[model samples]
Target: MINGVTQLEILDFSHNRISNDGAIALAKLISWHKSLQELKLCNNYIGSLGIEGISFALARSPALAHLDLRLNSYVGDEGGIFLCSALSQNTKLKSLFLAACGLGSKAGKFVGEMFKVNSTLLEMDLSNNDLTEESGELLNQGLIKNFKLQKLDLRMTNVSQAWEFAINEQLARNIANSTRNNINSNSQPNMKTIEES
Candidate 1:
């Protein structure tokens, strides 16, 4: 059922004992399937090598959009760097879920850098990860630089009060800006419609 299926649209192998080898096997299959969109391998034993394989595979995949690798134990700061590097070139991906993936300050720094340049990314879920204050600060700076991101989830990651306050302010400003834009857009009516009315 699995090995014979080459055109799978979604594959979820989360909470399994599969190691890097298994992850690599799945990643390799991406080359054969162009229809694969959402892939979830969360809570697996796949570590750095597996992540690298996936990163490499994503480099060539144009149809893949949403990827969920939450709770994977092998992805540290270095793996994060590689993943973000791959994401930099992948413009088709809109949503990325990497919650509780053991991201440290180093990884978070790279993630922050990724956000600074990747404008195609709309939503990112990094909740329950081990991101520290330093990483949070870096991400805050990254957020300030990039305006294309719509939502960023950092729930239960030990974010400091100061950082929380700052992020709150940023969210408030974002809401105000969005509201202003909507009001301005709605205020303008079609001249033809007005005349006809």
Candidate 2:
């Protein structure tokens, strides 16, 4: 399971009764840990400044696989933008969980931009935000050239039905393309096996 990343291999800080300042300070430590791969800060009441601190710290790392920040309702669009900007250049993260973090329509453009260049991220959860149809389309547009992301959850948002469907369809297409590519790459038989045959 994914725990709130505290820059340890798997440090879970969810519902730990940690103070906001303390959490922010701990989050800032992410910049120094090269082996740290996952961070989760779910339901921590972290504000935008805390998020900015964490984002800045996280941006310095070359790779991290998972980050869960669910239920930090105060990390609004500003926080989202900070995190997305930090993540845009990272290509090693595979899953991100941001459910109920209050990322509204304003964060959509940056989130979409992240999708455009990130080739390793595979899943994301943005449920319960007040995102609109336009935001959904922006995200979809970013996915047009991306074939790495396979799952995107937008539940409880205000995205229109049509746009939601389109986004899902695009995700499905990406999954299919990735699967096909993987199969094709692996289908090449080993030369030694061919010689034995």
Candidate 3:
């Protein structure tokens, strides 16, 4: 019951000192609002419990597209895993920001798994985490299968340069192939028209 605000689409509480209780309240609000598309909770003090609550709510929110949880240092690997599991069920989510959220290699693996099944996500930011080369390899395995992801930010993580280069190359190749297909499809009608004339 947020008064008459039933159609709220975007909720940004960045830089707020919202703790676990506040996160639970926000989660309830999100569950009630079916039109909410984006939620930003960056720099909050939400911990693993808070994240679990939020994840539960997000799992049911069909219209939420973007979720920003950056700089919530208390949400460690466990929280990351929980969020990833929830993301697997959320089909409308497109962008996720988990920068500096104390994520490590284990969480990275879960993220990779989520990507394999979650096809709607397009942008992801995992900067300033504790990821390692192993994590990068797991992520690469998922990226190879996921064609919808268009933007990825891994700055300040422990992922190696080689891995980054490979990911970039793959993305570029996908783009080039898609462009070529589009060009060929578009030219077919014109060629037919020219021949007919």
Candidate 4:
């Protein structure tokens, strides 16, 4: 079924010009392969319908960790919404790349909502999208509650200068907090050393 491989872990079909039908077929394949950990469908022509199929497949994939959907510009805000909804249920996903996927402010809001509850996602790239100041604010709201997210890329988006400033401030605060905690832990005397003394 999969070139003598029963349990596939990673599938990379990027730059293949695969459209809706191909995406649907891939989705079906993924549904049967639960061992899939990473899926890359970048630089394709998949649209909203295709993304819907993928989203449905993702809902059933418990082992999927990394997903790269970059440069699929046909999947607009609606597709982003569907994908984000699926991601909310996927607890194993750690890194998500959605750059240049025609996402807009509405999609940004959906991403924010996903981040609010998703505990496993560590890295996300949303660069070169249509996100604006309002979207940045919504993202900020989610960032305020999400401490598990370690990296977020928003380059070439429509995020405002003010929002960037706020984000930088928040990052600085988090770094300072972590540094202080590390310093405090290091300053504590070791129990073994104290006993010897």
lDDT of each: 0.79, 0.82, 0.87, 0.85
Q: Give the per-residue lDDT digits (tens) of candidate 4, residues 27-135.
A: 8876667688898999999999999998898877667889899999999999999988988887788898999999999999999898788777878899999998899
Q: Which candidate should be chosen as best, given lDDT against the real structure?
A: 3
Q: Taking the candidates one at a time, how many backbone clashes does each contain?
A: 1, 3, 0, 0
lDDT for model 1, on a 0 to 1 scale?
0.79
Query: What is the Cα-based lDDT of residue 133 in candidate 4?
Result: 87
- Model 4: residue 154 alpha-carbon error in angstroms: 0.3
lDDT by residue (tens digit), candidate 2, 145-164: 78889999998888888888
Which sections of candidate 1 miss by over 4 Å? 1-7, 168-197
Q: Give lDDT tens digits, candidate 3, residues 99-162.
A: 9999999999998898788878888999999988888888888888877777788898899999
For TM-score, the strongest prediction is 2
Per-candidate TM-scores read 0.80, 0.88, 0.87, 0.83
How many clashes show up in model 2? Answer: 3
Q: Tell me which residue pairs clash in candidate 4.
A: none
Sliding window of 10 residues with minimal summed lDDT for model 4: 166-175
